[model samples]
Target: MRVTRLLPAAAAVLALAGCGAGGGTKAVPPTATGSLESLAAEVKCRPNMQTDADELRQAICANSDGKFILATFATDRGQREWINDAKDYGGYYLVGRKWVAVGDDGVVKALRGTLGGDVEVGTNHSSHSMHGGSAHSG
Candidate 1:
């Protein structure tokens, strides 16, 4: 009797889980969406504008935690390409919607508390052989 009642509930749970199995369904939360200055404020830092252009906006920021670079991109593809290229040099990156923060692991981790994002580690080229393509310049 109890088993019969629980079967329908279990089936409904499974159906809901299958709905999200298509992948790429992860949504960037509102907390993760902001410009360089806005994001810096969340982490308690004033961004010293470095490169301000149509494609990218980068700034250096420092608070009680430490100093780091904060950048926001105009497009998603551009951001991904930049990250892929920069990885060759080896660094710590905090990735969010159209924005990325580069700093030491401790600094980046502290920033993550206020500005929710994923921490991506760059490849240390020194350990492996260098490929044909060069690192992204400016």
Candidate 2:
């Protein structure tokens, strides 16, 4: 029993030691839901954002190719509606907590992979776009 315990303890120590200076993979950044700054960091742009009284927030991240909006809904119903009634001129997404991100195919895919979330491609309305939604231009 003592030997078994020591083996487990030793394994833990080795694991900790491996992480000290020579970890295999770099750590993932701590992601923030409903945070424009955090989203901006991942997307390589300062986010232009909007928020409702309900704290429903949207952050627009763009590039030369296209743009997308990352949103946070005030209520689950609102989230459900946005998702179910979504138009796919760009990417459709629901992320952590009350967050959503929208953009075109490539942009959305890249963000989702990096930030983590649910995403879909295509758009229903031409007017519904991530373009120029930000407070500033890239």
Tens-digit per-residue lDDT, 5-35, candidate 2: 2223222322232211211233344444645
Tell me how many residue pairs clash in candidate 2: 7
- The most accurate candidate by TM-score is 1
Candidate 1 Cα outliers beyond 4 Å, as residue runs: 1-31, 126-138
TM-score per prediction, in order, is 0.68, 0.52
Question: Which model scores highest in lDDT?
Answer: 1
Q: Which stretches of candidate 2 lie over 4 Å from their true place?
A: 1-34, 63-65, 88-91, 121-138
Could you tally the backbone clashes for each prediction? 0, 7
Candidate 1 per-residue lDDT, tens place, 44-89, comes to 8898886677887877777776777787889998788777766555
Candidate 1 colliding pairs: none
